[model samples]
Target chain A: MIIYGSERVEDLSLRCDVVVVGSGAGGAAAARVLAAAGAKVVILEEGGYHTSFDFKQREREMLPMLYRDRATQRTRDRLVNVLQGRCVGGSTVVNMADCARVPRAVLEHWQRDFAVEIDTADFEAASERAEAALGVAEIAADQLNANNRKLLAGAEQLGWRRSRFHHNRTECTGCGFCLMGCAFDAKRSALVTLVPAALADGATLVSNARVERVVVRGGRAVGVQGVLTEEHGDRPAARVRLEVAADVVLLACGAVHTPLLLQASEIASASGQIGRNLSLQPQLPVLAVFSERMVSFRGIPQSAYCDEHLVFDPRVGMTGFAIEGIAGGPVQTAGLVGASGRDHKRWMARFAHTGSCLVLVPDQPAGSVAADETGRTRIDYALQPDVEQRIRDGARAAARLYLAAGAEVVVPALRPLTEIRNEADLARLDDVAVNPDATTLLSAHPQGTCRMGEDARRAVVDSRGRFHGLEGLWIADASVFPTSASTHTMIPIMAFADLAARSIAQARAARTI
Target chain B: MIPEIDRRTFLRGATGAGALLVFGGALPLGACVLAQASDPPPDLAVLSPRAWATLACFADHAIPRGGAFEAGASDVGVAGLVDGWLVGADSRLVTDLRRGLALLEWGPLLLGFAARPLTALPPESAGAYLASLTTSRLGFVRQLHAALSELCLLAFYSTRSAWRAIGYDGPIVLGLAESVELERR
Candidate 1:
């Protein structure tokens, strides 16, 4: 049953075998799997169950509905725009829906140092299942916009081995509206995929219930204490502390907020690694305008990626990053290309023919997440010299690709002064200060905040996803990923959540006697 | 502080140009509004006239006219939108934009000039002057262009033009075929 908001929490009315804190990719997946295994499940989601129909493209309204701080949640420095979905489906609802397995090297890293056994074959098998379940399929090339086609052609010309990405969507009409919440319900976010399935199987869901802290006694998790706010708003009409004693408590509140729950509970402090090793798949976009109408926003938000450079040797850090096709209208295009009034006017005029491409660079694991002075979570990442250099390299490469495909002008995320008309202009970015504040950096994929490792003293959770100090408490989100994968993290997140559920089910069966 | 947009021109973009054009057309006037009307047009009491004119021209350039585009920049009350956004609330962008606009040359003159009641000028004159600006002539024009570009890009990227430009085939427009698909699917 779906509970919209606080019903003046009757004392201990909620009881379940597992109580999942979040309802995102991990939480929703975990709930679906656990409930299917005949374990009564009650999932608590901080955001509302605002389906696609309820979504409006407006950021102000959608932020409160779909994002954490009305989607404006920023780091303490007030830079480094961090976006996360806050609805029943979590970021899954707002994600680009490009699913890729946890890279083999990332798994190997986990297994070698953490003694976690996520063999390549195991993840491959899990990925297959996830793909089938989520209806993941390549968006047909013919369905791509002219801009997407140009991008693909550019990558092909460079012989970079880029492949078209398949989204979980079955019905996509090429609307550039994925970022604002899909209006067609075609994007297979967890709200439509897992949560619906979980709901049908008799799983209980409570929306607008923000879990404040984990209830612990005798050094073990008992239940969680959370306040149920009024349905859509945050005014505390009535405060009810919820405590549901359960056999298992799964923390899937994602990387940023998950550690705060553990920190608030005063758990996982012995290792002091609760909120460390912040991984931001920091992305940079370069927009190109062609004389012909390419219209960047039409095709899938991210339809293709180049993984030709994904490697783990000493010289190269991680594999090459994925590239996404992006575009917007006059207002948006003007911002990127329109710095001078003339430039702004020209860019707006050419908005219909502009194509945007983004290089999804995986920043080296140099940054970390820490709670701020107000006890609110904050992520601080100083781009390593190499990472910034890599971004510059990627920008130059992307500009070349766009220019090769007849792009009139290329706008790199560097300085507005740095506009690329041909290959010659791309070199100027090498000297431009590509620092964190100077460039527009966005991170949708956050992993390794509450990372898992072999030792209890060094890692927050065990390889099997069990919290080091607490029994029956496990993390099944990207938080458990010891390292960031080379590709998109959604598929790997699903596989890990599935594996965690299977482990819990096995443990329960073993104790049946 | 930046100047105010001509209220007459701003209103044209708000309603005359069509509802969709309002987003980009009115994005720039917000940095520092200097409405001279009793108590400064609600939110915009700080901006001078020249800042408003720059904002007006900036909004005009952003959501441009011609090619049968019914909504001109002035249709959206682009000036009013800027005023509303600046004085109505406090945000990072609002604060930054205020500081940024204050840095412009002749900023005080523009702010003071904004207080006078605005009269609609010939559209051709507005267009010609806007067309004359170059990266070399006025750095402020370049700066305005950049800020306007960012604002329009944000609006365009987030608004309906993006969806239309991208060829979105969502179910919002329920045609006969769409209804059939909705029922059949």
Candidate 2:
């Protein structure tokens, strides 16, 4: 049964076999598996329960409704805007629906550098299950919108490696509003898949319930306690208290939040690695104006990517960058124009002819998440020197790609309106400072905050996602990734969560026996 | 060893001191002391009167009327919309924004563009001052400019009135006749 905590006037108490905090890709997947295994699971989601019907496809309305901190959550320095969903399905509900597995090199890096061991066959099986459940398939050739086609064409002209992305969307109406929620329900997010399956299997979901802390007794997590908040808005009013007693407590709040919850619960690791090693995988938007009307916002926003520049090292995993086709509504697009008054309006006037792509760069874990003096979450991330160079190189490469694709002018979202008319003008980017606020950078994939490994001195959770030195406490989200999972993290997160859930279920069965 | 002053002179000095204190306290209350002509929105929720006036002026300059579009941020009440959005935002963020707006208003003086505030400058001069902020040597100043610029652009373009000029057809979901397909597990 699904309960709207906002409607409750009295305090609530419940007992369950498993209490999962968060209802995103990981929490929902784990909840489904545990529920199917006959564990009485109770899922507590801090955000409200919203479905496709509630999606208005308007940026102003949907942003505040579906996103955390109204989609304004930024790093401590305000250099990177970290966008994560705060509604029922977490980020999976608002993501671009790109599905990818953890690259082999990344897995190897985890095993080599982090001592994180995973059975290859088991992981593959879990990934296969997730893909099948989500109806993951390659984007059909006809489904490539003008923006994506431009990306593919550019890569082809430059003889760069490119491919159509596999997505979890089916019967998509080509509405270009995926960054907002998908009103058509075509994107098979965790909200429509695992969350519903878990609920159908007798898992109880409480919406608008924020889990503040885990209740630990005798070195084991016994329950979780928090408050039930109002249904909507960035700062919802706390209405009532909520407590859930469970044999196992699973935290799947995204990388930034899961670590905060652990720290608030006083569950410090011996390694002091609770909120270290944050990887933002920041992406920069590059716009190209074409002669013809591309009408880029009519179809799927992101369907193809160019991986020619993406590099993978045996030691460090994924590095370098990948360029993916992207478009947004007028409001989001205007924010990237980097001009004011007439100049800005002139750019937006040609909105139909503008094609955009994001330069996705994978970086080493070089950030941390902590609470400030005022008790607000503070994500501290500054671009390292190498990452900044890579970003600049990536931007130049993207501009070259657009120029190769016959774009009239290529514009990287930078201040002072740095425009690349021809290949010679690409050098202008070198003079541009890639410092904070000098360019627009956004992070949709934030991982590795509370990383997983074998050593208690280095990792917050073990290989099986069990919190080190703590019994009955587990983590099953992107927070457990030892490094950057991939360019896209939905599928990898789900697969890892599936494996973690099975481990938890087996442990419970073993204890019962 | 004290020298005695005239009683009339002492009374005058005390009265003048009281007047200075009263005027000094009231000066800050006139929120937009530099731009006394502008007023805050009627439905203010979070922003103070000075912040509201500064933001409104910034919005006007950032997305002024009569360029490629007829509707500007001021025409769509972008500042008012942002004020409403800030109502539920984090208190710290709200405080930072208030300070940022104040800085923007007084930026003209600090940047040596003019002795007056941003709102007091002519439309062209105000636009130039805002442009100068984008390339400012100070990172926080540039950040403030970028923040307000983005907020104004987002708020302005989000309105339906700004759609036609940009060639957007708005959302298509509301007009769909067919039902969306659902695949159950």
Candidate 3:
């Protein structure tokens, strides 16, 4: 049931009961559920289908194959790099496997603000089902890597709200290569689990097929049209033009592409929210080199977390953010630590001893994703002043936590601060310019591009992920999230995707399709 | 054998690991090698020899030579990386990069500094010139520096020699054995 576009010979004309336009957590999960319900499913992925066996564990090699545009996605100002998986598994394949539940507070806010109609019990049940489906498990204390242990110790020393992280892995080995696509098949990404299960249930998956636009007729979505980038292998020789027809069309092309596809397809949102209200969890990494070896890249990339900064009170808005551990491969480490040059080299030389944590800001929907004249995705995003100030505060907090754990020198600022030896230098973070243009703010979780709500005036989809005007069209990805959730988005998005897919299945069962 | 990725611990980069893509665009070493094979890399997709020299000079100045850092910019062939990056990029970006490098090369003489090419200038002179562009009153000049420096830095640091100088122990997994191998990904 898995078809490689590289090997495809000629034009394609396929039909299915459900045609999903992505193969990430949401799309794969939906395919599995819909296929299990006896609905013929077909999933189309723009990127090549790669798994652990093909993971060479080299950044330059893997990135181009696994990530979209080789992970060079840029915000309008080119300040932040938006990294999302482009392969068959979508973002889940490259994600750090940090799974978190939907905070009741966020659900309550959604119900109150967007009027999304899901009760607490139903939401919890949906989440529970997803967790079980994905084989979500807890990280044991014995398996804590040195990098993770340091953050845990630091958080404990600082009295931060620290806890273990849950991940979707069967027998993970702490190899710390999740961001590079797990080499041992330990991460249990959708490629290994949901996609396979769906395939087992007779689902068809087409790889390297970039859907140019959704084919609409008489205001009803009938199928998708796209081009096959390769006849085989990893070459960019556009070959076959693909045409896929389906009873139901699901847009799960992540936050960025889903909205862009909608616009390109000329699907009217009526709510003016096709690509509006782009919510993001922006990152500011605070690095500190310890006297002892941390070797932050040795084990699980994201083993420990501190949610203490998630200072949320629907009344006052989300004030604080999360601080977690992260270290990249050598290339990523060298490229991101500082601006070009000697000091940047100095930071890399100390890579082994450096312990890094990011201050994550749960941001408002303060941006838009637009395609340029060439049809490339560009995010027009800016950090609000208050969020910038909070990030500054969180950077200091993370630095202090490292200092509390006895880091020798803390490099908190992206463009080399004077080196923090004590609280005095840490306080200077307030003096540093908080310009989003200059900051090394990276957005990890992007949601709400085509948000779901009750009102068509402000939302793109309904509670069940149905498009406002189209009957057989739906979205089951993070694009439909109304607000940014306060944790890793994998579980919440899958849970919601499962919910959305269930609705589609019900419609088919009732012959509504 | 590669030790298993432990699912037991609470690993984190708590601030959702920054959303942005790290480093420059797809850095396929194949393309980089092919691009550099040309002399001064003429028929260059992005930079001419003089312009390539400007980038080398700027990257060398940025990292400089001293301390434990032994390799300079051209030693690792950053121009090649830059060329490959530009070949796949929009012509506008490649043109912008050319324009910026051209300014760095010729801007010195026009602005009444020493008449030496930027590549041949002393570190202090080169440093001062780059600093001027970085802090230039014209925001355009500053923006140009940002674009130019990013590619230079990424290309320079991407070198194995540079990584060695920085004491980075290469990739995390050297290779996985056959026992636990799955079907080709």
DockQ of each: 0.11, 0.30, 0.19
Computed on alpha carbons, the lDDT of every model, listed in order, comes to 0.64, 0.84, 0.74
Worst 10 residues of 3 chain A by lDDT: A229-238
Indicate the TM-score of model 2: 0.92
Task: Tell me the interface RMSD of model 2, in angstroms.
Answer: 15.6
Off by over 4 Å in 1: A6-13, A58-61, A76-79, A231-240, A314-317, A328-342, B1-185
Q: Compared with the true structure, what per-residue lDDT tens digits does model 3 show for residues B1-185?
A: 00011111101110111111121112221221212222465456666665666666666666655544667566766776767655544444454455566556555664566574455466677778777765666545555565556566666665667767766665545555423563353
In the range A134-156, model 1's lDDT, one tens digit per residue, is 89988787767787788888878
Q: What does candidate 3's lDDT look like per residue over A97-133, in tens digits?
A: 8888888888888888897987788889889988887
| DockQ agreement of candidate 3 with the native complex | 0.19
DockQ-derived CAPRI band for the predicted complex in model 3: incorrect
- lDDT of model 2 at residue B174? 56
Q: 1 or 3, which is superior by lDDT?
A: 3
